[model samples]
Target: MKTDQEIMQNIRTAIDDCTKGIDDAPSLQYQIARKAKGEEPVVKKISTTIVLVAALLAITAVAFAATNGIGITAFLSRIIGGWNVNENAIVAPVVKENTSKWLNLTGTEAYWAEDGLSVVLKVDSADDEHVVCYSNEDGLLDETGERGEQIAINGEMAPLDQWRGEKELIIAEFSPLGEGWNWYKRTDDGLFVIVTFSTPDAEALQKGTDVAFQIQDTNIQTGETEECSVTLALPAMTMQEGHK
Candidate 1:
């Protein structure tokens, strides 16, 4: 696996070799690259078309590393320890959303790598009353601060009446259940989440795969649980159409 520095250096070396053939003065950026050249090689005159093609590689190596403000990058940083749009990574803009009761789940981006598949989600509702929780015991506590219930929420073990700050919460951990889903960010309209799954099917997902997970909401008092199975059909992404 090549680091971003390695990638940039390789591209610059290729660009330097390309400039030697051009009759025209190389751009200032390319000029700087030439000074770092190692042993002198045979200089053969080449067409400007080849130089432009080499420049494209330089753009892809450097520009794609920055995601600007993307939720997918946030999740990736946790796994990789930093921001990196590596050669093996695929970041594609996608819209695959579903709604269950008042809870609306939207898939904004798709990230595929060797480990598994993950989708960046935006979870919202018609109102602000519910908090995210898992049904399992090791997860969030029940509304009454006990361990038995179908509906879930971040009860904070204080019971229903005392619950506060529901708006600013974003789920950090994914479910341990089959095909787990994930974290979010506070948004004016709603929250952004990244649903991740652990599977050995990276090869299959990269070719396009269908994924589904449970997303539910609970009415704290009524205990009425509206659970929906959200399905995401991430499109097939190739090397040429990736990292943007």
Candidate 2:
């Protein structure tokens, strides 16, 4: 388990050792000119090429391990301080079973604010056609603006240009303002989404804080509402980020 710096250093050392005293350089420009002239351009031996490729692969693997590993791990890291969710969030991997037997929802990360809580949920459905989704303006409209004819919000059909903001929309079972918005994307294994809302009580949050919450979603096909409950407590920023 080498640190990034150590791994880089090891790669550098290997490259140097492999290319030791093998200065076949006529300069890159000159080598290219030689090749252009139909001459055998100066090149490293196959062993050296193999070493370089291996080193490159190792570097790539390290980079991926450092910050791009697995779906859930990267999901938590990516939204740690964005989307109204911040570092003060307590990120716990929660596999909460939804009411629907065909689908499963997991809370990968979340944060509690005075207003309420925001949770990142990953949905895995056995039947692709029976996937879970929270109907909103964005999801209703596709690239060709097809759903434009019939707009929907909060899993219910609404008139075109019918306005609904966070204040008017209350989504979660326990949230003061459910912050109902359709925000989700597809993943290889399942669907990734973020659920945010206002809490009934505005409680001051400090480090090592724990809070419980419930997130709900509806099926587009069957109009079935499913909920997953979870509690998260982790190191949190006491104050809103970028403020005193």
Give lDDT per model, in order.
Answer: 0.50, 0.48
Q: Which numbered prediction scores highest in lDDT against the true structure?
A: 1
For candidate 2, the lDDT comes to 0.48
The RMSD (Cα, Å) of candidate 2 is 18.4
Q: Which stretches of candidate 1 lie over 4 Å from their true place?
A: 1-83, 87-99, 127-181, 187-190, 238-244
Candidate with top TM-score is 1
Model 2 TM-score is: 0.39
TM values, all candidates: 0.46, 0.39
How close is each model in CA RMSD to the real structure?
17.9, 18.4
Instruction: Give per-residue CA lDDT, model 1, range 1-244, as digits (tens).
Output: 9999999999999998887767575555664456557434446668997676556644543455454443433343233212234544545534444546556565666665433455666555545765543233422455563543232232233442333344422122334236554554433333456666756255666587677666655554355656556677766754322222
Sliding window of 10 residues with minimal summed lDDT for model 1: 168-177
Q: Which parts of model 2 have CA positions greater than 4 angstroms off?
A: 1-90, 93-97, 113-116, 126-129, 136-182, 187-189, 200-240
Tens-digit lDDT string for candidate 2 (1-244): 8899999999999999999766875557766778789897566667876676556655544454466444553343333323333444445545433444444556676555554455666655545444333345434543332445343433356553343221122122222134533255444344456655554234444444544545555443334555655554444444344311
